[model samples]
Target: MSKETRLREEIVTVGRSLHMRGLSPGSSGNISARLDDGWLLTPTNACLGELDPGDIAKLDWEGNHLAGKPASKEAFLHHAVYAGREDSGAIVHLHCTHSAAVSCLDCLDPHSALPPLTPYFVMRVGRLPLVPYHRPGDPRLGEAISGLVGKHSAVLLANHGPLVSGKTLEAAGYAIEELEETAKLFLLLRQQPVRLLDEEQIEELRQTFGAQW
Candidate 1:
């Protein structure tokens, strides 16, 4: 298969996986992958469970929609991150239950929302920051994400959900899942005494795993 064809099929496959896993439901998320010319994004208002590979939207680096369905309005947010982080080849934004629940809680440190609970969470998703709430598709949301994308590969949108970028689509998908599960753990263990990874431990993970600490 051609590169474009492979990417299209991969997008559909990942979308279906995410939907079936309950990470994204009811058209409440968007997925995109960087392309040679620009990128491919899930269509606006399209359910992840029902995406057609051929109907995924395509755009130039300039953000002009070139083919297939109309692109998600949050495509700009993906673009902003790609522009800032050359290593990011794919992005996944989802309003998963646990992560969104964490986003709604008060007094979260804007710098690092989820503490490093498990080694896998630290390895897969390093230092997730929190973005102030903005209405869905608000242009300012892109700006907010852009400001922090260079420093963080993942961020939780306050009162919204998590946005994660990775070197590949699978990496992005897995990272978001880790973030969601970690968020769930955080909530479950909030009242109990927990052992979080210390600074030295986090640094060790970063050095060993090459996480974007």
Candidate 2:
């Protein structure tokens, strides 16, 4: 198979995995992977569990549709991240229940976001910013992500979902899953007065993993 063909298959495979794992339901997520000439993305309103490789949409770097099915309505957000972050090769956004529930709470810190619940989270996700709420497909949502593209690998859209980007689609999906797991842990442990990792431990993990900000 050609590179584009392989990417399309991979996107569909990952999309099914996300849906099956309950990261997204009822077409509530979107995914995209950069291509040599452009990009391949999941179709709009399509159930991720049933995606076909041939139906993945193609778009130019400037967000122009090049071929295949209509792209996800929220494609602009992915484009914004890719445009601003040169290292980004794939992006995934999921309406995972735990993460979305956490986003609704006003307590999330905008700066040092996504508490360092575990060393893996600190190493993979780093700080996950909480972007202010915006209606789905609102152009302003893309604008908001554009500001944090270079700094954050993942962000929680307030009351909506989490968006994550990485050097590959698998890496992006893994990071988003980590975000959801961390959010679930946070919610579960919030009432127990748990002792989080100290700054020294966090720094040690960061140094050991060479975590990028």
Candidate 3:
């Protein structure tokens, strides 16, 4: 298949997976992938489970609707990340339940990224900052994400959702999934007083996986 065709298929596949896994309900998430001339994005209010590959919206770097149907209303968040970080080729945003629940807690560290629950989380997600809450599709949400784009690969918006960027759409989707899993783990372990990985092990993982931030 052509590159664009493959990207469309990938987006559809990932969107369905997110819906099936309960990471995003109804039309609560948006995804986008970079293209040579512009970008392809999911449509506003489209059910991710029923997303049509051919119907994905296209836009230029400036967020102009170049082709296909109208772009996602959350398109600004995707554009902000892409414009702020050259390394980000794809972006995924999801209202996964566990992550959203954790975002509501008062004790979670807002700046520590994701906690070192597993080596995979350390390697794949690193540190995910907590961006303060903003109304859905609010311009301030994009502004908050823009500040952390160059430094972090993922962020959890307070009372909002997780936003992840990656070199590819699959990678971005995987990171967002990982974030949800990590949040689930955190909740499950919170009452048990579990032993976290030691500082030495965490440092070693950091050396091997690079910085969490």
Candidate 4:
């Protein structure tokens, strides 16, 4: 199979996993992987649970459709991240339940959306900033994401959802999963007196595993 074919199949597999695990539902998430010439993105309004690999949209670096179904309206989200973060090979944007719930909360830190609760969250998701609200499919949201892309691989959109980028499609997949689970834990423990990973411990993780924090 060609590289593009492999990526399409992988995107389908990952999307299906997200849907099955309740991380993506309805037509609420979009995914994309970088290609040599462009990108392979899930089609607009397509259910992540039922993605057809052959119908995955292909687009150039400039976000123009090249083949397959029409690209997700959030194509510019992928475009912005890839342009800003050369290391990102895949992007996953989702309205998973817990992450979306966190987005709706009013008091989250704009610079760091989630507190460091788990070491894996710190390692996989790093620093997750929360982007300001924008209506679905709004192209202007890309500019906000791009502005927050310096060291962050993930961001939670206010009243929206989370967008994550990683070095590979699988990496992005894993990171988003971690984000979702961590978000869930954050909500569950929100009322309790929780001992978060302190700066010293977080520093150890950064020194030992290169955690993003």
Candidate 3 residue-wise lDDT, 39-121, digit = tens: 99999898889999989998998778877778888898999888987888889998889988888887878886457888777
Off by over 4 Å in 3: none
lDDT (C-alpha) at residue 65 in model 2: 88
Output the lDDT of residue 88, model 2.
Answer: 90
Model 1 spans with C-alpha error above 4 angstroms: none
- How many pairs of residues collide in each model? 0, 0, 2, 0
Q: What lDDT does model 3 reach?
A: 0.86
C-alpha TM-score for every candidate: 0.97, 0.96, 0.94, 0.98
lDDT of 2 by residue, 88-183 (tens): 999999999999999889878986556887887888888888898999989999999899888988888999989999999899989999888999
Q: How high is the CA lDDT of each candidate model? A: 0.91, 0.88, 0.86, 0.91
Ranking by TM-score: 4, 1, 2, 3
lDDT of 1: 0.91
- Is candidate 1 or 2 superior in TM-score? 1
The global Cα lDDT (0 to 1) of model 4 is 0.91
